[model samples]
Target: MSVISDNNDFSFKKNERLYHRNEIQELFKKGSSFYLYPFKVIYIADPFEAKVNPQQILISVPKRKFKKAPDRNFIKRQVREAYRQHKILIDPEKLNRNLRIAYIYTSDKKMPSDVLTKKLKKTLERLHQEFTV
Candidate 1:
């Protein structure tokens, strides 16, 4: 992950989250994906005429895999926290276009927070390499 000198750069604001239904559907329908253990990452790069955050992300923990609401919520929280901390790894300026990404939790078992953070770091690193190329 790339280091940011300013601490405020780490915040995960509402605008940085991908939550609209239409956007979610488009990302899943048209995006390319890769699996990295617990996360199935789908992403697309598209230019937008209107100014927007360079990247926005959606995180999902399936109901089928996690039968209870709390379990699903817990995983989502972990994923979101990890993303918020490590997002600086991807430099938005270099992307030069809007990037939409979805992270679907695929593992049936809940992962420890430390392991989840490590995996998320690797996932973001991979994404950084993919876009920077």
Candidate 2:
């Protein structure tokens, strides 16, 4: 199979792709954004300016609601899987363009894995369209 066909072959070059606390806090002061969705997915996509890499795309679940590591971890894993599956849909050429996307779970409860997967795909589709537009 061609390399592109292998999702595992995609190079997520760095572990620091996700913004650190200081970076997110600093983004509020320095960076501006184009609205992608309803909820404010506050992000600093600057680090991606250097290369066509997915420096980090964060998906945060609420802490107050889950109140347990297992629940949070499960939801995080589901989110990561959904991203992994759909990420290749977005081109590497365009990767650096929309680099820092922070997809926060604004909902109240932890949705089922299937439900989250569906929502994630829909959101990614919208992002692809908007990014290309």
Candidate 3:
């Protein structure tokens, strides 16, 4: 697919991350969202920035559910890795717009990497399908 990068490096770079406070607020307040078990995806499509990638994502692990800092960090790390591996499931060109997505882990316990990856794949596919229209 044209959207698949040849690099295959699968590195999650700074540009691919959602960091702005305004953007994050807008995403949760106005974006369309859905939940799939451990993840709740909130996304909004905006005009593409001149040199930015087609998507910027955020991963949130609530401290309320995972009180320990280590637990939260570990879950966030797993989510990031999963997204890094399967991100191309969404065709960038088809979007015609830049997507800002937030994947929030709602579960109170840790999940296996394999299961997390599978769920993330499905989540990405679902995001693609939702925005493709």
Candidate 4:
């Protein structure tokens, strides 16, 4: 297991601040977002000078698709753990600019964890690359 210290702690725990629903809703309304699939990652960045940290990330696997709460929770857990373990995607080096990101899963079914990890890694890499540019 890897320790995600410093800028790599993706858990967004109590010590790390986060954005609120109203803010997200407002961003959604404004639509300054980006999407990469296996999911649609909706991000609303402050069009300002720079950002020291990612405000927050929300993961969604639609309840309408999974239907079973437990199943949905399981997938959500997997996604969060993956992000927690590998948050270089949200690295502050990249955050020399500002951003607020939301990950919304559009898939309609559950896949194994291994498969999910691979996809997540790809998405994170893409986000990292995009973040810098």
Local accuracy by lDDT, each model: 0.88, 0.61, 0.87, 0.67
What TM-score, computed on C-alpha atoms, does each candidate reach?
0.89, 0.69, 0.89, 0.76
Task: Tell me the tens digit of each residue's lDDT in model 4 across 49-86.
Answer: 54344455677788788999898899888887776666
67-133: candidate 3 lDDT, tens digit per residue: 8999999999999999999987775655677888999999888999999999999999898887776
Candidate 3 Cα misplacement greater than 4 A, ranges: 1-7
Number of clashing residue pairs in every model?
0, 1, 0, 0
Model 4, residue 85: what's the lDDT? Answer: 68
User: RMSD in angstroms, all models?
Assistant: 3.5, 4.0, 3.3, 3.4
Instruction: Kindly list the per-residue Cα lDDT of model 2 for residues 4-82, writing each as its tens digit.
Output: 6444554443452565787566655665444432223545444345444454576677788678888878877787887
Rank ordering of all candidates by lDDT, starting from the highest: 1, 3, 4, 2
Q: Per-residue lDDT of 26-56 in model 1, one digit per residue for the tens? A: 9999999999999999998886434776789
- Superposed by TM-score, candidate 1 places the C-alpha of residue 99 at a distance from the truth, in angstroms, of 1.3
Q: 118, model 3: CA deviation in Å?
A: 0.5
Q: List the residue pairs that clash in candidate 1.
A: none
> Which window of 10 residues has the lowest lDDT sum in candidate 3?
1-10
